[model samples]
Target: MAILPICIYGQPVLHTLAEVVTEFDKELHRLIADMHETTVAAPGVGLAAPQIGIGKRIFVWNYADQDEAPAIGVAINPELWIIPPEPGQADPEHEAEGCLSFPGERFELRRSAAAKLRAQDADGKWFEISATGWFARIMQHEYDHLNGYIYVDRLTGYAHNEAMRIKRKRNWGKPGLSWTPGIDSLEG
Candidate 1:
């Protein structure tokens, strides 16, 4: 497995909706392996196919809670459902959210506290998973990428403006912005 270069926010590939994965063959498995390696190298909680310039409906995520071991898996052609928080449940601290594509940025984006996801594994076996808290956040973030949406797109008002300002300053929303893990400085 090789660590692939992550596409920055400006890449057109990222904005395009990813195609569904129909062939569960060796090529798909290899892509999943590379995605896992790239995600780990990015040191990110999750990554989508589009983030790595692959327009296939796939993603890899690794998230751990204080009480559990890390949950790592690949999701192909995933279908997600956002579950509303319990009555009186507090909202998530949106400021803590970050994306690998938008590297050095964080925004106050709202998302459900829990989610239900149905997806196929690398071998084409299907499974369902329920996630909450940070895991749910990661799921939503990666799912957005499959639909050609970014976390920043969910921001509003002042927060949205601030995110755009940051992008413009770094020329990230334009085409051809490049990134090299461990070498590029993403100082925001």
Candidate 2:
């Protein structure tokens, strides 16, 4: 498997809605393998197909720090629903999230405390999974990518302003992008 070049914040693909994965074949398998390798190399908790310049609904997530963390592999054509917090419950945690597409950047954002996911495997097998805490947050972030949104899109108020400031400084908010894998960004 090869590490694909991550399409940065300026890439149009990251903003465009991804197409559904219809055909499961050798090419799809290779892409999934490459994505997993790239995720590990980037040392990221998750990644989506659009980040690699492919406008397809797929993502991989691995909470590698945990001893029993399960590999997310390729979640194709995934659908997600955020679980609402209980009544009288405190607000969900707001935490800083980093993206490989936006190297050296992190934005504090709030998301649901839990989520349920429905997706197909690389071989087109359907499955459902539930996540909470950090894993839930990561899945939400990656799901946004499938719907043509980056994590920055979720920022608000001061966080939004700060993110925009960084984007402007790094020249990362433009529309076109191209990069060589591993050579483009030290972290990516």
Candidate 3:
């Protein structure tokens, strides 16, 4: 398995909705393996096929305890539905997030603390799941990739401006720098 070069922002492949994988063949297995290797190499919790320029409806994520190694798995032709934040679950705060595509850059973005998703396993077996906490965020973020959405789009108000500023600065040769948007600017 090899670590694939991730497609960064502005890549046309990333903006296109991924095609569904209909066959669970050796090639599919190999792609999942390569994706797992790539995700670990990048030290990310999850990854999607579009990030690697495959444009397939596939993603992998694991939320096992930090002490335990990640359980690498794949979702083939997955579907996701966002669950509305319930009473007393309002205002999920922003979390600092990084993407393999956006190397050396990070942003503060708010995401749902919970989600409901359904997908097939590598063997084409169906599964339904509900996730919460950081795992939920990871699922939602990666799921967005399948739909041609990036984490930058999840940011609101000043956070969006801050991410753009840092993105520009990095393109202009700024490195090893971190950006933090003012919390007061976040919308509820």
Candidate 4:
């Protein structure tokens, strides 16, 4: 397992709809392990295939509530269902989130409070999970990546403007930009 370089906002893979994972072979398992290693190294809650320049419907996530041990797993060909978020502007302080693709930037975006996800594991076995709070947020965030979206694309109000400003300042939103975790100063 190794820490893979994360694609930045401009990468084409990060903007394209990821393809489904069909072959559960050694290659698939190795990719999942590398993704898991990279997520832990980045110290992020999750990482998606597209973020690592792999256009497959796969992601790895690690989460732990204070009351429980860490839950870590790979989701292959995921299908997510989220409870619609309340209608209103997102709370800037409490709702802020960052993406590995965007790295080091956080912007507020309203998201569902609860979510139900159905996906297969690394071995192609199916399972389901219900998540809330930050776990749900992680699910939604990674899911968006598989669908060719960056979290910044969902920003609204002043946050949306701020995101655009940052995008322009960084000269992002094009292609071929990326950063290696541990080596790069940027973190998400």
Q: Give the alpha-carbon lDDT of every model.
A: 0.82, 0.81, 0.72, 0.88
What is the Cα-based TM-score of model 1? 0.90
- Candidate 3: which stretches are off by over 4 Å? 66-70, 85-94, 172-188
**Using lDDT as the measure, which candidate wins?**
4
Q: Clash pairs of candidate 1?
A: none
- TM-score of every candidate: 0.90, 0.88, 0.80, 0.94
* Candidate 2 off by > 4 Å: 65-69, 84-94, 178-181, 186-188
lDDT, candidate 3, 92-123, per-residue tens: 34577777666555666666677777899889
Question: Tens-digit lDDT track for model 4 on 76-170?
Answer: 99999987999988887889999888777888889998888899998899988888887888889999999999999888778889888887888
Q: Tell me how far the alpha carbon of residue 16 in candidate 2 is from the true structure, in angstroms, after superposition.
A: 1.2
Query: Candidate 2: lDDT of 138?
Result: 83
Task: Estimate the overall C-alpha local distance difference test score of candidate 3.
Answer: 0.72
